[model samples]
Target chain A: MGFIDARELPDGHTVETDVCIVGAGAAGLALASALSSGTGGARVLLVESGGFEHDDHTQYLHQGQVVGREYPLGISRLRYFGGTTNHWGGNVRPLDAIDMEPRPWVPHSGWPITRAELDPYYERALAFLGLPDDAFELEAWTDGKACRPWELEAELAETEIFPAVAPELRQLGAVRRASIEESANVDVLLHANVLEFETDDPPRAVRAVRVATLQDERFRVQARLFVLATGGIENARLLLLSSSVASAGLGNDHDLVGRYFADHLVIPPVGDLWLSDPELPLDLYLERARANATGRAMGRAIFRLPDGVQREQRLQNCGVQLGPTMPLDVAIRRGKAFRSLDYAWRAVQEGDLPDDFHYHVANVIADVDELVAGGYRLASYRAAYPTWHVDLIAVAEPAPNPESRVRLGDERDPLGQRRIVLDWRLSPSDQDSVRRSTDLLAAAFALAGIGRVRVQMPEGGLDWFRPSPHMHHLGTTRMADDPKSGVVDRNCRVHGIENLWIAGSSVFPTYGHVNPTFTILALAFRLGDHLRGVLA
Target chain B: MTTPFAVRRRDVLRLLAALGGAGFGAGAGVGAGAQAEAASRETLVAARVRLRLVSPESASLLGAAYLRDRPDEDSPAHLAVALGLDAGATDIAAIAARHRDDLRSGRVHRLDGFGFSRTELRLCALLYLTDRA
Candidate 1:
């Protein structure tokens, strides 16, 4: 494997490779790794806009780094070789079998491939990322015969709330750095930006890619196959911004280059808890949430909420937050109130929320004072990083709102590429979903006889509604069977274009609450395999 | 049986103390005085009431202090708080945006006229004067 830094290359030269892959993020790196050994001696070029994080400007957010002060949540996404894997929460979950199915109730729903089709890739993905086994079915980690969580306290929550995890704090660059060095077929290029694409006459097969450095040096890399793995927002922006021949852009037959843009409207919640070990210790929930937190089967487990549970009975997602804290008095009955960040996290989008959606923390009054003072305060946690103490984000699905989308802003990046103006198109349908979901969860809370919900939606008064980023942006260049329906075909190749392909969460038509890292990796592997087959 | 809604100040303090850990007992004082101060502040409190906004324009002046908790950001709420709009009129979107920062710091504020949803009691902003009625 060879690494090329885009900052170098003072003289413009044309290099030939079997495949020229653009953008060295998770999708590109994963695809490179998948093909590294599979396609023997096949030349694969992996281009990154920035250098490694040690000297990387992105690590410090140098372009527009505003540490401490929360400037308008300009993307926390990294642009270097590894991309966002630098700060991923590492909770790898397979998209549920149902997620791939098109529910009559769910709008614009479908996954061209099923969960079963991606299972093998899921296994290999976990292996490549150096992640622990699913740990979901091991008996020591679970009940004796049935396989369960490893700890005793986890059983309570597990019996009631099942959670899944990917638990590896993986840095994709490190994974690629270690793996690519041993590969004979891949070339990982740092700081190599894909400036433009050159196609052959008539058929329009991509013949070569124009690579450039910020230093004004230029070069070319020719390949049989080309992949635009430049992330969700950038991929679409580049195509729309790249108006050399096509007026509507590269894959704009349906005008879907940057249209159906989406991210989860993160509705964080603050709820009260006074868990006692009368039959089980508060330590059980605490230890689970503290240690495992959905990855190790201890905290924030994943489980299916019985359908028809909510009044609307809509098929939806469920992940809970209630952990170990010192015993205290729950004033739910007294109509007592302690403003927890939890309250505002849920109803953040009902109002005219920001595109990078968020909410305010009123106050978090614990049923027990000790939980607030120490046991529950973010600064007190030892198992997890203390800095993650603030509002617990209870991510909610921002149902497909065709209106909430990304458009080309009047601004441009350094490359003269159009600046993306994101308008988080939301509607009453989203709020309706939240209200109904809240009602359903409250009913469940009532049934469990735990604590009643004291929800205070934004409509209550003159409370400011600040929206936060869900970090799960998807669906600008969706894949569908028809050219008119989506920009790409099932394999993620641009419908009209011969050699252009896309990678990332962008291809997803519908956004799910579960993190997309695991699924994203699987898709990348599939794409890599397709590329190899083409070369063969 | 449902747990009785009995709130003990020590229980509150103990909760904070546990979170503070062996290092900072100062965080342990779940100060009842502080709670009482918050409860009785001159701010028009809407304990579990709907907090709606009429528009994005008024989000800063009335509901700025009560929007999202920034604690350290240079957002409108931080600006409004600095400008003395702790408990004034605000919009639902403004409150929600401000709340984005509040989640990180657990800050609170109150404005006039606010309302909450009928089903789950979530906040919804119509106008500040509506907070009382």
Candidate 2:
């Protein structure tokens, strides 16, 4: 078997391989599987800090202080083999072409590699993700019934399709674990925590990696090349921790190691869409079974502004999804009644009334009939269709700000490694993008005579509506053509260092308004093909 | 002499009065408070006439029936008093006019003291527009 318990190995043992991958998460495992299956003659060593299941001791290592917003650090990520994909929702989308182009208004906002360069790899990544190899065409999936004639001009807004494969069948560990076990030239080592890189003089090239096990076992893995497939945060953390050679960091010669952190900002429901044509079949815009496909579900059709509109308005990429809404009174009463009963039951269990017990009871008494009617509507419509209106929930792309970064804190973990301090910052341009995009959409709907849209601003206005993080960590170690602007080059190799590279969303220069897993996998495949060519 | 709008208005007024009386009678004994019941019936009639020009069918489809069947505990008199109107007065037309003005000014007028929600306030605005027409 390719699996090896690193703790069982003899102390001071040295293993030799052609390539040593530091992490066994989604990117790491995908790259390892690709290399092992290739015709190349290179042997691979894949290291994982945690075992097959969740381990609290290893999970606790991810805990750290959050500065700007209240972020749940400990629960946001997993330390196991599959990484965060253990709980991912499996939403995949490719970055738009505009997302890869440099916008003059947005500082440090462009990719060294364009979307066209990644298109072939994205097609290959679909097989890895278990999605259909065909293009994400809405007509093919919906049997031509999905597209409805838009009354508005197509330049204003367009329908975007999102396809979701079964997450369980496509999880990295679940899909490739068997193949990895039977591979002849690949070694899977669990509980092997990569501590630092031991480099030759001048530290321009990586020679060996030092790994430590929880049981105090130490070993060295010498390889021809080393790839840091660790996640966005840890990739920078490992580089920063390996300061014995470069002082600032291995790739920090230009002082740009851990910078340009970004995450998608999901704005709260900003408007309500009351469709004039009540007979319009909205099932296509909702989660439903594909017409001919079995065991696969088609995601809701999202509305995105066309590229021309985005450029004209100078707004960031944002997409809107329709969410069911109801009269505020009905929703409040039903919610209050349900919460009251839940609190009463909890009070019976705890033997004490909650502080807001009377408030809940009074709300239930005030609108009992409306509450009953709301319940009937909810039961009949399944809470997916609103009785009167629907809300416009916008998922927006945040601008790349060099100030929003992840740095090492003074606190140390059980392994004596410094923890991360996340300062997640959003710019004023980010908020402006959301506001302007909603305005343009509302204007388009009005011009088309489809319906009226009422922008629902908070009592304190747009500033009061704080954008919540989408947990998509990206852009920390960005890719740029020059070493002065980024940590990695176009090939994902460390700018000045040889035999060292990066994988995953850490190399994303700009994050589009979609999930990053598919893109991460595609980039890993590209890197794998490149490494195969180099090693051969 | 009644047009279709006026006829529909009358029918809606009768329905609203009936619903209000039935609800009030259920909550409070019908025979014990005949004077208060008569006053609620008059208020419902006045409200129906004031809302005659609005699309009563659309208003009913939007769950106006809930307003009648489950009227808030506070009476129209209490709402008028809270709005700084004279006591014993329930001029829904005047209330609707003020609400329309607040909406035109892009301000959300507080209706919590009058025991009404935004949906209920919208219905009141429809009544006001009908009365003006």
Candidate 3:
């Protein structure tokens, strides 16, 4: 029964533990819960910067500058007990085998660990995520009764199923707080911001983590082992902040800490799908199917190229999701209004006067009639079968780029820690892959007699489209077999550090097009098992 | 093998690619077999009258690319039979209506990655035959 508030702790207090897990996100929580469960479980200390709920001061620590492209550095993630899972949409799927393999076309690709090595832990991870089973096929959810998936040409495109935990059970911090708090072997520390890692003369091992609170309460947590489960960006930031022993940073002998950053690129409304049959059985693909016999969560179908085709085309993995059909004019009006409003909002958020704000407002006002009509049509579109038109949204994999990185900014946060500067850039091939993949999808849909697709392109044409990062920060502390190529080794241990390990998507070497949460937890559960042996 | 009305195959491939069609097969030039199958003046007039939506030049370009993959469908009448477009037709509106109906009813032909209705493919084939003549 230990849930310590660092703000209330006396100054200069020291707490000793067997294992100190930092940042109580999905990975941290999973590790804490796993390490503290059952007899012979290790005594664990879990530390989180934020408490059970959020406060402004704690959230402000996440503020960072975006130099390469406009990214939501501050808002993309939350700094609460559950971490970003607090607002996660709950889409979960394991990476395809091809995602882990090194492709000749993609630079800095390949994972130190294979999918086969992580397969056993995926089921456990699913259970941890409150999913009953790990059946990912479309028929598994439908039993071939409720609906049938689109029979696209196998050579061109294949159906991929993604299961999602229900919204009610998504937030791990809210759901597992009681169990985690009740664990006798674990002590949870709230509002404890880890400032630096104090290591030996050569920084070969982490002796203790120097922590502070917003209230200026300073404390220390010494442990036999330390795990940084903060996040992709924060993990790298903290490592860079710990400059006491290693001049560059802890485990910075190779200077590979905050490189190879990647995130799935989302291009919304890339095209419109005109179905040949209005009554096509699209329940499994469109509206998500409910829990099946195995009690798996709701599942929906996504489309992507088969692995062989992707390799043959020398393309990165790109997945497409279909949105509900609406009237063409309504879609146009809605898109225009939303795009203008989005631009204005982003400009305002960046502290710049919204350029053409009045013009966009005027355009929106002029589009009011069509927008209202579209909203009404969308509500009644179910009855009007002949007018079905769905928009295609592409979620593409980002190739590992060394230039795309997260670095320590000059500005210091309230906790006196350097804020991060994220230069998240996409390689030219990244956009090319999406364009080629979308074209192939369009052709495949037409040739299969499925439908025609009217692809959306800017003035730059079909070959180009503006892409937004899908808020999935990955590969900042990438894992590899060698120290020069990655910050962490195959076991997620910082290469030069003996007692320090990294967890979560930050260690993902090559992030796949699907959501990263499933793989993140799988790695965490695997790490938990590994640390259990070490602690024993 | 150049004819007065011969359209460059590269132009056709580029157009097909732009139309979201897969231009898979032989490289950039018309095959001698396709160049040899010439259409009569009557066929050209009928094709122009029937497929007014597609110009003779554009239809010839699209049809040449389509036939390059399926050499067996080189003959305009044979291609028409294969596409189920050999039925009696009254006017351009009837052919257009049938094309739309065919697309809706799954009576379609696929070539160079573009999904084509039977009526549309047959009209294009006839236009190609006319261009060769």
Q: In lDDT terms, which candidate is top?
A: 3
Which model, 1 or 3, shows the larger TM-score?
3
Sort all candidates by TM-score, best to worst: 3, 2, 1
In CAPRI terms, model 1 is classed as incorrect
Each model's Cα RMSD = 16.6, 12.4, 11.2
Q: Across residues A459-511, which tens digit of lDDT does each residue of candidate 1 receive?
A: 43213333355677678888787888777888989887888888888887776
Candidate 2 displacement at residue A444 in angstroms: 2.5
Give the docking tier of candidate 2: incorrect
Q: What lDDT tens digits, residue by residue, belong to model 2 across residues A1-536? A: 48888989899999888999988888898788779867366899898888888999888878888996666667767887888887777778898999989988777889988899999889888777766654377665454443443455587777777777674554577667888888888888888888888887688999888888877799998999999988888888888888887788789888777787888888767677644444445665665534223235445677888888888778889988777555553464447666675556656766878687777678668767766776786666633332234678888999998898888899988888888899888877888788767766764553353444556653444457587778888888899999999999999999888899999888888887988888998898999999998897
Instruction: Say which docking band candidate 3 falls in.
Output: incorrect
Q: When only chain A is evaluated, what TM-score does every model earn?
A: 0.76, 0.87, 0.89
DockQ of predicted model 2: 0.03
lDDT over C-alpha atoms for residue A24 of model 1: 81
lDDT of 3 at A164: 91
| Comparison by lDDT, 1 against 3, better one | 3
- The candidates, ranked best first by DockQ, are 3, 2, 1
Proportion of native contacts present in model 1: 0.00
Which runs of model 3 end up more than 4 angstroms from their true locations? Answer: A38-41, A143-146, A292-296, A327-387, A458-464, B1-133
Candidate 2 regions with alpha-carbon error over 4 angstroms:
A143-152, A291-297, A325-374, A377-387, A458-462, B1-133
Residues B9-113 of candidate 1 have per-residue lDDT tens digits of 232223222322111112222234333443432222221111121221122122323433223432333433432233543233444333333321223232332
